[model samples]
Target: MKKLFLGFCLLVGIATKAQTVADQPFLQDSADKFSLKEGEGNVNLLQVGSDRNKAIKVLSSQGLMLLYEKNLRQDVQYRPLLDMNIVALTEYQGQFVYLTEKAVLSNAWAGKLYINHGIEAPKAMGMGPDFLTLVAGEGNFAIFKNNQEVWRSSIESLNPISVQYDPNSGQFLLLTAEGLYQVDSVLKTAKKVFDGSDLTAFSLFEDTIVLGTTNGIQLLDRKTFTLNKLDQKLPWTEITSVNNIRGNLWFGSTKGAFKLREDGKYDYYASKRWLVDDHVADIAEGPDGSVLVLTQKGMSKIDFEPMTLAQKAEYFQEIQRLRHIRYGFTSDLAMRTPGDLSTGYFHDTDNDGLWTSMYLAGELFRYAVTKSEDAKQNAYEAFEAMERLTALPDLKGFPARSFERDGYEVGLHANGFSEEWRQQWEKENGRIWQLSDDELWRWKSTTSSDESCGHFFVYALFAELAPDKEWRDRAIHQIKIEMDHIMDNDWYLMDWNGKPTAWGKWNPEYVNSFPINVGDRRLNSTLILSFLQTAYHFTKDKKYKKGAEKLIKKYGYDENANRPATVIGFVEGEDLSNKWNHSDDEMYFLTIPGFVNYSFTEEQKAAHFNAAKSHWEVERSEKNPLWNYLFALSGGENIDSEESAWWLREFPMDLIDWKIDNDHRKDLTKIAPNFRSQTYTEVLPGDERTLHLHNGAYRNNGGSDGKREYAPYIYLLPYWAGRYVEAISAPQAE
Candidate 1:
C-alpha cells in the first residue's frame, strides 16, 4: 500500500503572513545603492553631521580617522590623531570634543588637537550647548562649563549605558539596563519616565523615544508615557543600538543592521553585500542621504534607495553581452560549465537544444517588445543552433543532445551504455555523426522528452511570430518531422539504437500505467496534449488532433491534465509526487503557452487554462520570476507584478555558480523540512539558493554546480517575457 500524504494542512501551518501596505512599505527594488570600505580592524563608532557637506569621523582599532563626503569616496584621507586610546568623540555647539581616561581634548577645531586641564577623569559624557555633562563611577554626575565644574549631583544607578542631551526637552537622558531617566541641569532631581529591563539602546525623536530591548523596538510616547511595541520583527532579537537619523530609525543588532523606513517597512544589510561583518556596532546617516555602517570588520556606506527600472534594463543588457561572448555554447554530457567560451574551449550539453530554445524564445519576446534588430539576430542565431541538433543525429527526426568538434573527446561518457552501445560507437559506426567536409564535427545521440517539449514550444512560437518566411517554413518542417517520428514510433522518442529513450515515453501503455495521483502521469499527459495541439495547429494535420482526442477520451489524459499537484508532506510512501521536481514544473508551465494558444476549441483552451492555474497556485510559494512571468502571460490569476520585478533585481550580478551555504545562519527561521517547498522566513530562495536547484529536487540535494557559472539567459528570459506581456512597466528616465 502506498503511504498517505497530508495535503493542504501542511501549507496552512507555513503560509506566509499577509502583506499589508503598512507592513511592506517598500517594493523590493534592485539597484547599485551601496558600497563598502574595509578598515584595518573593527570600527567601534561613526559620527557625521546633519548637513550633507560635512566630513565624517570613524573610530576603529587603528585610531581616529576622517572621510570626506563630497563624492562618496572610500579613501581615508585624514588621521588627525592615530594610535590614541580614545573613549568617546562628540560635537558640542559646533565644536569637536573627545576624551581619554587621563586627559581631555577640548575644542579640537580645524585639524588642531588641544588639551584642557582642571577636568576630572569621567567614565561617560554627554554634550550640550556650551556645556558638557560628565558621569563617573558610583553615580557621580557633574556639569562643566569651559573645563570648569559648574554643578555636581549624585544618582543611585551605578551602571549607566549611554547619556544624551535633547535640546528640545532641555534635559539630559540617561539610559540604564534597569530603566530610562530624565535629569535637569541644576545638579539635582532625576525623573524616571519609563521602566524597562534589559534595555540595550535608545534614540530620542521629537516627541517619542525608541528603545532597543531583547525583544524588539519599543516606542515610548513622552506625553502619555505609554509604551507601544513595533510589530515589525528584526532579523535578530538582540538589538544593540538605535539611531534616529533624519526621522529614519536605524537599528544595529548582533546579527546585522536594519533600517526602518518612515512608512513602516524595513531594509536589511548584511553578509558581504553591504557589511564586512554581521555584527553592526553603530550606524550614522551620511551627508548625502547615504548611511555609514560600522561593523566588526570595517565600515560600509549604503544608499538606502532602490534602483529605477531603466537602470535594471541596462544592467540586464550588459550581462547578456558578457554571457554571449563568454559562455554561450556547449558540447557533450551536461557538464555544468560547458567549457569557457572566452578561451576557445567548447563542449556539448545533453539539452543544448532545449536550453537554447528557451533563450531563443526570450529573444523573440524581446524583439517583439523593443523591435531591436539585435534581439532578432540573437533569436536567429539561437534558432540555427537548435536546428543543428535535429540534423546532426542519425535517426531521421531525432534531435541529438549536443554537437562539438571531433578532437575533443577526452571525458565523454554516455548515460546508460552496454557492450552493444560501445560496439555501435566503436565498431558498427553508430551514435556518432560527422557533419563537416573535414569530419571535424561530431554529435551525441539519445534525446529525451524534455528536448522534445522545448523543440515543439519554440517551433510553435517561431511559426506564429517569426518575421521571415524562410524561418517560419523551417520551423513548420521541423515540427512535422518530429511529430511524425514520435507518432510513427508509437508515441515515443526512439534512440539511435532503435530503442525508446528512457524519458521519451508518452504512449498510453506508459502514461496510463502510473496511478492517477502520480506526478509523471499528470505531467506526461499535459505535455503530450500540448505537443499534439501544437503540431496540429502548425502542420494543419487531422491525425494530430485525432491522437489528442483519443488520449483525452479513451485514456483520461484530460482528467490527468486537470489533476492538482499533491502537497508533498500530505502523502506517504515513495511516490513520485512526494517530492517536487522543479524541472518538471518548468516543462509543465512552458508547454502551457503552446497548449492554450493552439487548442482546437475554446473549451480545450479553457481546460488548459484551468490546469495552468492549478499548477501556478501550487507554485506561487516558490516566488520564481520565470514561473510567474509565464503564468501571467498565460492569463493566470493574481499575477504578482511586484514579485516578478523583485526576482529580476535580486538576481545576483555574478552568474558564476558560487557555493552558497545559508544552513548555518542563526537568523533564519527553520521550518519543517518539506521536499516540495523552498520557502524560508529568513531570506528568499532566490537570494541564497542555487540556480540549478530551481529545476531539481529540493531535498537531500547538495544544491548548485560548484564548478561552473550560469549564463545570462536565466534572467533575460523572464525579464523580456515580462516586458513583452506588459506585466512589467517600462522604466522611466530618472
Candidate 2:
C-alpha cells in the first residue's frame, strides 16, 4: 500500500495554501466531446438538399448520394444516373424526385407538379408543403399544388437569384441580384418582399427571413415585409449558403463556415477541422443534433458528445499508451502518408525526455489526487524512461534529449534545418548524436534549458509524492547529481567538451549578457535559483542552499528571478527577444511549483508566488489550465477559473494536425500584428484554432498542414495537475 508522504504534506502547509482543499462532492457541470467524420475526395458538393424521410440527398458530380447517418454509424448509397439524364434531385413523398431536361418526375407522385408535364429551365426552385415553385426567366413565378398548376404569374420588377421555402408561413421566398421577393403559392400571387442588392442566400427562422449577400447578412420579417439588416459581424461575407438548422443560423461562405450565436457573436468553424475545403457550397441540418457542412470537395459531420474532463483523461491515457509510447518515452507520430494515422510511426524526437517528463508529471498528479494504481504504474514507467536519459549520457546528472537504435537516426536532420548547418552547429557546441557505451544504441546531446527544467520539475514531484522508497530515492539522487554538477561547474551545465552547451549556461556572465529586456536573462536566473532551492528542500543539503544564496546575494539572481516574465517583449535587434517564447512560458509555469512550494524561507515562498501571479496576469487571456492551477498554489483567491474551464471544454477531440486558418475571420477583433502574435482582441475558442498544445496564441490564424498529430499530453498535464491541487474536482456524472 502506498501513501503520500507526511513531510510533503507539511511542506505544503509551510509554503502556501496550494493543496489545502477538502473533497468537493457535488461539482456537477460537464462538457461535450467532439467527433468529426469526414467524407473527403476530389468531387465537388454541388448542392445539399433535405430528405423528408430518414436520409439526405447530396447531389454531386459523381452522382446522387443518399447519405444515412446515426450516432457513430453512417451509410452512403450512390446512384450514378448513367441510364437517366437527370439535371436536379429532390425528395417528394418519401421517394426520389428527378427534374430531368424532358420532364419533372418522381417515383411516388402520380402526375407532374407543373401542368401539361412541362418544366422550365429556371435559375432556382423552391419545393415545400402543398406547392412546388420555380422562378422562370426574370420574374415569372409558377406554383403547383395537389398535382395542379395553381398559379403562373409575372412580376416585372424582380431580378431572380435563388428560391427557398419558409415552413412557418407556408410560403416561398425568393432572392434576386437586385431585390428580394416572396411568393404565396396558396394565394397564387408573387410580390416584392424587400429591396436589397446582391442577395445570394436566404433561410427562414420563425418570422425572420435571414438573407446573405456579398456585403453581410440581413433579416426580413415575414409579417411586416420590412427588412432589417443584421448588424453583427460575420467570419466571412461572400456568402454561399445560409441555413437555419433547428433555429440556429448557419452560414457557409467562400472562406469557411460560422454559426450566429444568441449573443450575436459568431462561432467560426474553419480550416480542415470543419470542412473538406474552405469554399463551402452548402449547409444543412444533420442527423441527431449534428451539423452537416458541404464544401467544394465533400461533406463533414461534427458531433458533440456529452462527457466530463475525467472521462476524457482516461481516453487520452489509453491512446497515449497505445500509439504514443516508444521505448517507454512519450514520442511523436510521424505519418509516412500525410493525414493518415495508419501510416504513422512512433518517432524518437529531440524532446522525448521533455515530453515524457510532462506526461510523467501529469500521472504523478493523478496518482496524488486519486491514488489510482494504474496512474502510479504509468508514472513509474515514464520515470524509468527519464532515468535512462540521465544514466545513458554518462555525465553524472546530465540527461540526453532522446535515444534510439544506433543506426536509426544517425543522419537525420530535423527542425527544418539542413544537414550541413546542423553539423556546423553541433561542431560549434558538441556532438549532438552520441553513440552509447553499448554498440546497439545512441543518445541525443546538447539538451536545452527547457528539457532540464521539465526533468527537474517532474523529478521533484516524484521524489516528494511517490510512495515507492526506491523510486523516491532514485529521484532525489538524480536531483543531487544535477544540482551538484551545476555548482561544481560554476553555475553552468557543462558538456563533455568542457564548455557549456549553448543554452545550458547559467553563469553570471552568461545570464547577464543580454539586456534586461531579453527573456533568457530572467528565465535562466529563475531556473537555476529554483533548482538550488528545490535541491536544498529535498535533500536538506547546506551546500545547495549556500550556492543559491551566493547567486542571489552576489549576482542578484533573486531579483532577476522575481521579474522573469515582466519586460520580456520586443527587445530591439535581439533575435531571441523578437517574439514571445511560448516554450519559456511552459518551462516557467512547470518549474514555478518547485520554486514556490519548496522555497527555503517563508519570505522566498511569498516572493516566488508573487512573481508567478505577475506572470499569470499576462497569461490569463491564453486560458491555460496548467498556468492557472500552478499559480493557484499560492492559494490565492484572486484567480478566475471560468476561462480555464472554457479552454478545457473547447479543446478538440480530433488531435490530428490538420492545416488550420483563422486570419480571414471577420468576427474576431483583430489588432495590429506584433511580436507576441496576439493577433486579436479576444482569443477564438479551442476547437476553432490551432492545437499546438501550450503554444496556442491568443488569436493565431493558421498552422500545420496535416503532416503530423500531437499526442495530447498537453490536455492531461493541466487536467490532472488541477485535480491534484483541488482546483478541479473528480468527474461528475449527470
Candidate 3:
C-alpha cells in the first residue's frame, strides 16, 4: 500500500485544530481601556476584564476577587450586578452561562467563546431574572432575574451574540465574528468598535486586544483603536490558542506554537518542529520547566535541560563503547580473498555461514581518528585492506551469494565493477564479463542501492588516511565532485546516488533527505561535521574553510521557519502533522550539540545557544531521550545542575551515557533487552546475514575496528569534540 491515504487522513485529524486563533483580547470603550492578566502557579489565578465605567474581577476557583470601578470608593456597597454562573473552569480554558432570552453578545465575543470551549461544544444558557447583558465563552457576564430580562432596553436592534464586562475600563464589550463593538448596558444602546475584520482567535491582556488574522497576529489598543502588527517574522496562518505561562506569552499557531518574550517584544521560543505543522493543538507547561505538546498524534512531554544533559552523557558514552568494541572485534575475523594475509576478528554466527566483514572494516577506518589506537593501526589496516580489494580484479563478476559447499561453485565470472570509479568504468566499458561457472553471476547488475552512506565513508576514509600526495590529491578531487553533486544550495544532501545510470539519467532529489532515510539529519550534520573536520585536520586548504562557512549560512537557523539548533529529523505518523498537513512544518531539535562548537560563527553560536535554551524550555519531548542529552551537552550549564543529575541517572541504556562511566553502568535485565533487530526485506539470496550481524556486534565492546557498523566514525566524535577517545581504542586484554 502507498500509505499516502492513511497518512493524509491521520494528518487531517490532528492538524485541523491547529488553525484556530487565540490571542490576548482587550476590554475598551470610546475613551478608556484596561488589560486582562492571569496569575501563575499555586497562587490563585486572577482574571480581570473591564469596560468603560465598570470592572469585573474573578479569582477563578477562589470566587470573585474584586469588582470595583477605576475610581469607585472602596467603602461603597459592593455587589455583583449580574448573577451569571460559571459553566466551565479549567487551568487555561474557561466558560460562563446566561439565558437565551437575554440579548445576544457581539459575534466577536461569541467566536472567542466557541474557540476556548474547545471540542466540548456550547451548553445552552437558560432564561432567568431579566437579562442585563450576556458574555458567551469567557462565561456569562449578564444577570437574569426570575423569567424576565434584567435591564430595560429601548434599542430594538440590540441582538449581540457575546458580551464581557471589563473591570479596568468599567464598560461592557460585545463581540461577533463579523466585528467587535461596545454596549452601554445602563443606557441600552450600542456603538461600533471595529468592523469587517475576521477576528477568529483573540486574547485580552489589560487594554490591549490581540487578534489573529489569516496571515499574522494583530494588536489593537482598545481605547484608541490603534492597530499594531505583532508578528512580522513569518507566515502565521492561524492562532490556535494563546495563554500566559509563568511570565511568557505563549502562542499556539497553525504552524506549531511558540513562546513569546515576557518583555513584550516578539522574541519566540519553541521546539524545532513546532512550525512543522500548521496548527498547534494544545500547549501546557510541565513540571520543572518542561513543555507539554498535544498534536494530532498524541501527547508528548519534554524536559529540555534535564533531558539534554542525560542524552549527552549517554551519547558520549555510546561513542566510547562503539570505539572499543570495534577495536576488539576486528582481531577475530579471517579474510576470504587472496590479497590480504591478515585475518579479521569477526565471524558469522547467526545466519548462513559466509565471511563478508570488509564493510565494517571500511566504516571503522572512516571514523578512526577519535580512538588513538584506531588512528595508530586499525585505521591504516582497514585502508590497506580496502586498497587491496580495490586493486584485485573481480575475476568472477557474480559470485554465488550462497555459503554452502555447492554454492561455492555457483559463480564463475569477472565483474570488474569496483567500489571506486575505476571499477565503474570497467563495468560500463564492457571489460567486465560473467563466466558460466560463476555462482553469483548475473547478466546485469545495478549499482547497490542504499550505498550512498558507504561512499560517504569511503571519501571520509580517503580524506583521513591521506596516505601520500597522490592519495591526498585524488581524495580532494573526489570529495569536491561528490560535494558538488550531492549537496544542494540548502546544504541538504541528496540521499540517492548522483552517478548517471546506464541511461545517463540523474535521480531526482528533495530539499531534505530525512524522511526517506531514517528521519535523522545526521547525514546533513555529518556532511557539515566532515567538512569542518577535514578543514580542521587539513588547515592548509581554504576550500574546506569555505565549505564550512557555506553550510552555516544555508541550513542554520530561522525563527519564522521554526528551525532549531539540534535537529532529530521528522517522524512520519499521524500524531505528528500540523494543521496544513504539510511535512514542511515539522522538525525535531536534536543533533544541535553535534555541531554546536563546530564550524559556527559567534552569531551562529548565539543562535544555536538560544535554540538550545528553547528546546530545553519547550521542545524536549518524552518520546525522544536522545534529543535531551544532545541539548544538555550544548546547554553550557553546570554539570551538576538538577538537569544534569537526571541525565546521570539514565546512563545505562544510552550508549553515550554508558561510555561516560567506562561501561560500568548496568542494563536492566527485565526492563530493556540488549539484543538489536533489523529487517532485511531486500536481502539478496545466499547473502551472509551472520557476518553482517557480527560486524555490528563489536561496536559496544570498546573496539573501533568493525566493518559493517559506523562505530569507528562515531568513536572518533569525542576526539574531535575534545572528549575521551581511549574508551574506543582500549585493547581486549585490558
Best by TM-score: 2
Candidate 3 weakest ten by summed lDDT:
659-668
Q: Can you write out model 1's per-residue Cα lDDT over 67-140, one digit (the tens) per residue?
A: 54422233244343443455666565445566665445643455343434233435556777765555443465
lDDT of 3 by residue, 310-341 (tens): 13424443453443332122222233431122
How far does residue 319 in candidate 2 sit from its true spot (Å)?
A: 2.2
**Candidate 1 deviation (Cα RMSD):** 8.7
The TM-score values for the models, in the order shown, are 0.76, 0.89, 0.33
lDDT of 3: 0.33
lDDT of each: 0.64, 0.72, 0.33
Winner on TM-score (2 vs 3): 2
Q: Which candidate, 1 or 3, has the higher TM-score?
A: 1
Root-mean-square deviation of each candidate, in angstroms?
8.7, 4.4, 23.5
Give the winner by lDDT.
2
lDDT of 3 at 654: 15
Cα displacement (angstroms), candidate 1, residue 412, comes to 7.5
lDDT of 2 by residue, 1-734 (tens): 12223354475553223432222222222212122245545555566655545465666655565554432222233232444445556554545665554455564555445333354444456678654645343446566665567778777755566677777777787788777776787666677768777778887777787888887888877678686666447788889888887788899889888888789888777777666667887876654566777777666665555677777778788888888888889876778776678988876776788899899988988888888998899899999999998788778888778888887863344333688978887767656788888877888776778888988988888987787999999998988888887788888777767777667889999898888889888888889988988898789989999888988999988888888466787877888998888878888887787777777777887888788778888888777887887676544444556566667767776677777777766677878877777888877777888778574456465557776778868889888876765666667656
